[model samples]
Target: MAQLGSDLDATRAWSKARWRSELRAARRGVPASVRFAEAMALSNQLTSGRIVRPGQTLCGYVPVGSEPGSAQMLDDVADFGVRVLLPVVAGRGPLDWAWYAGPDSLRPGPYGLLEPIGERLSTTALRIADLVLVPALGVDRTGVRLGQGAGHYDQSLPLTAPGTPLVAVIRDQELVPELPAEPHDVRVTAVITPHRGLIRFD
Candidate 1:
């Protein structure tokens, strides 16, 4: 029985890897002009949709590489009168948090990501977020978020308050009907896509 369980885990991981590579290729195929426009659209929607109220803290991140949204989008979230806490990759465990001061405050961190220069908060600090914006490769209509496969958000999201929205940010095409799932996967409550805006699931 244990061997069977291990085999299933290996198969699921392979499926997720294939999906990740395919989605990455799709993102890379997008024209630079269109990508920029989509990023702007995402920023407009997230800030205007009132996901985070004034004075509330938002657990968010700075989009890197071919990811949806941009660093400016994070700034826009901050400008919406909410405090933004960007993740700091710590080893291979759950992520840490830090206040996003501005463009000047970001310093390079682990996993080739940018992190804030402010005081690093522990994983439990996620409970302070009114809304959590998680990065993903794609998300199914069922809210099974296909992340970058690093499992960072997987470990980090459980620290949030039960009622806080665990939202996935992706491009319009990345929202699919279904994706491979594992028991440990943290499903998102909602998804934000460029043209699709924000779509919620039960």
Candidate 2:
């Protein structure tokens, strides 16, 4: 984790909030066609990159609202015969998981999230995932992900087995040179963007 002073920490927090607003606005402003194109591009990149083998388990989430992804992206990944688990927001604690049967299998979850309507599994399910694709407003080159202040992923990601590829799915512009960081924050090992495909951090 990057060291920081008290004043620097405060500044970074404020900066994160500002960046969140700016990025949200930018996403909202994107044309529907452009968003769809980008989403499909992301799906193709994942499928073609062979990030997860056919038998590997993958943990992914359904992109909701202006989240910079489409339901088709998750569906396409699952089509590879890989077991895809969707996040279940059981409470404020670590996120649970349920098998992604299909898009129709999803129901409205808390905070407008789309969760699977199947047998729910615990966070330990994450330990088996060969790859984890998490949502992010932005990600720095150093792998520090700028997430929603909720800290759900930050807390839950620690349960994963060491060296699991935790990838943050974001737009090309969302990849930055630097961002705010804290000691407790769990950094992403890689980032996948529409055009850039996957960029891994050492």
Candidate 3:
């Protein structure tokens, strides 16, 4: 188990480095507007089947640093009556979340991440969320997720209810056949991609 943990961390670090380089290259190659549009479409399709309904909390990510344009995706989801909650880097232990009222509610924070400018809404408060869209650099068809090596999402995912759906957001090509996984590495139930839409592992 120790060996597996060490190996997973090592592979995670390597994968993160490679993904950063690849993302930079992809940005240079792909049109910014096109990527944004495709991503928006993918997100919309993913949430379409699920009934967000008014008052349902949807845990989401803030589009900061190298994370994808999920901030915009949250906005669209919010418009659909889902109360969006964005993660705040509260500490190194696990991810804490805050309510995202709008663009004005966010402020730049550590590592360029944006968080709630006002009092943070405790992640525990949003425990009844119907859905949660996780941010990931890559994910495999079998639900193996590759995060940014910080393990924030990995640590926070397990806190959700036994059957809460965790969906990873990645590019179409980022969904691979397999990726290095650790016992602690949380796998998302489904993946949302620009061209492919929602892909369920089961």
Candidate 4:
């Protein structure tokens, strides 16, 4: 029985790895112009919608590489008088955060990410956020998020208070029917796509 469980775990890991590779490649295949346009549309959806309220502190990420949204979304959110916090990865542990002042405050960091160049906040700072915009390769109807393999958000999400709105940002087509779930995986509360805006999970 133990051997069976070990084998199953290995198989799931392999499956997740395969999915990550395929999804990342698909995102990369998109033309830069199209990605930019879609990102702008997504920014409009978020800023125009009621998902984020003024004066609310939002935990958001700076999109790197082929990630769906752009850093402009964070700026747009901040422009609404909302406080934006972005992640700062120090090592392999839970992600620390810092205030997103603007595009000028960002500096290149490890793993091709742009981190805030400000005072570092503890992981528990996530509890202060009214909403969190998480990056994802895909998300299913059940709120099961397919994240980058490094598990950065996975480690940090547990710090948020229960009932805090965790929304995954992905391309519309990346919202799929199902995904393999693991015991340690944290479910998202909603998903936001350029075309779909905000979608809630039951």
Candidate 5:
């Protein structure tokens, strides 16, 4: 157990350092115009394909800073009858979630990601979630995910049921063949890209 704990700490540190570098490169001001176009096209395809269901609690990310995907995807999730929830980064632990009513209820928060204007809820509330759209820096075919190095999602994801369908959202190019993995590094079951709505692994 001690060895596992130490490995998780080391992985967290490495992931965080890589995120700083990636964020700087992304924020250097070259627009994600191509990525945006691809993302929009992908969103439309997913909607048309009916890959999601209604009344299912779906955890989504606030697209800001270096994240990919369009606001259209977020809006569509709500419109499609899915109960959307956004991440509420409260501390160094697992991520908490709150109801995502709309963009109106979002306010700027840490790391440029939007937060709920109202109260945050407990992690147990996310137990009802059927799908979680994980934010990733990279993903591998074996279902391993590379996150922003913050153990937020890593901690939060396992709290869901074993087959809750975790999906990593990223650019197609970001989906590589392999990534450094650790015991606490949560693995995504599917990879969602601008070109691919959902790529199933296991």
Candidate 6:
């Protein structure tokens, strides 16, 4: 039984790795102009929709490369008087949080990410967020998210208060019917795309 479990774990890891590589390559193939436009549309949806409210402590991220949305989303959310918290990658452990002051408040971090510049908030800080906009390569109707294989968000998501909305940010095409899911995989509550806006699973 233990050997079978170990084999299953290896298979899942291999499947996840393939999905990450394929999705990332597809994202990178997108035109920059299209990406920008889609990002703007997504931002509009987030702001116009009731997903995030004013004065809410929302946790968001700065998109890198062809990832859906843009830094503008973070700024736009902040403009709504929402206190935005961006992730700060600390080694391979759970992510640390920090307030997003503005674009100027960000500095380049490891893994080609833009992290917030401020005192590191405890991992428990995620519990204070009214909503979380998580970065993902793909998400299924079942709310299974395909991250970049870093497990950063996976490690941090458990810290959020129960029932807190964890929204996955991905492109419209990336919203598929299914993806490989493991016990440790954190399912998203909703998915946001340029075309679909926000689709809630539960």
lDDT of 5: 0.73
Superposition error at 137 for model 2 (Å): 0.2
Tens digits of per-residue lDDT, candidate 4, 52-137, equal 88888999999989999888888888898889999999699889999998899999999999999999988889999999999899
Report the alpha-carbon TM-score of model 3 versus the true structure. 0.81
Off by over 4 Å in 2: 1-14
Score candidate 4 by lDDT: 0.86
lDDT of 6 by residue, 1-202 (tens): 1121124454344466676776777788889899989989998888884788887899999999888888988888888778999999988989999999998999999889999999989888999999999999888778999898888899999999999999999888887666789899999999989998889995
Clashes of 6: 0
Candidate 6: the clashing residue pairs are none
TM-scores for every candidate against the unseen true structure? 0.91, 0.91, 0.81, 0.91, 0.83, 0.91
Error of 1 at 159 (Å): 0.6
Sliding window of 10 residues with minimal summed lDDT for model 1: 1-10
Question: Which 10 consecutive residues of model 2 have the lowest summed lDDT?
Answer: 1-10
Local accuracy by lDDT, each model: 0.85, 0.84, 0.71, 0.86, 0.73, 0.85
The per-prediction CA RMSD against the true structure, in angstroms, equals 6.0, 4.8, 5.8, 5.8, 6.8, 6.1
- Model 5: per-residue lDDT, tens digit, 142-196? 8888776768888898899768888888776666555567787878899888776
Whole-model alpha-carbon lDDT for candidate 6: 0.85
Candidate 1, residues 1-202, lDDT tens digits: the string is: 1121124354344477777877888888889899899999998887785566768888989988899899999888888888999999888899999899999999888767899999988989999999999999988778999888888899999999988999999987777666799999999999988988888999
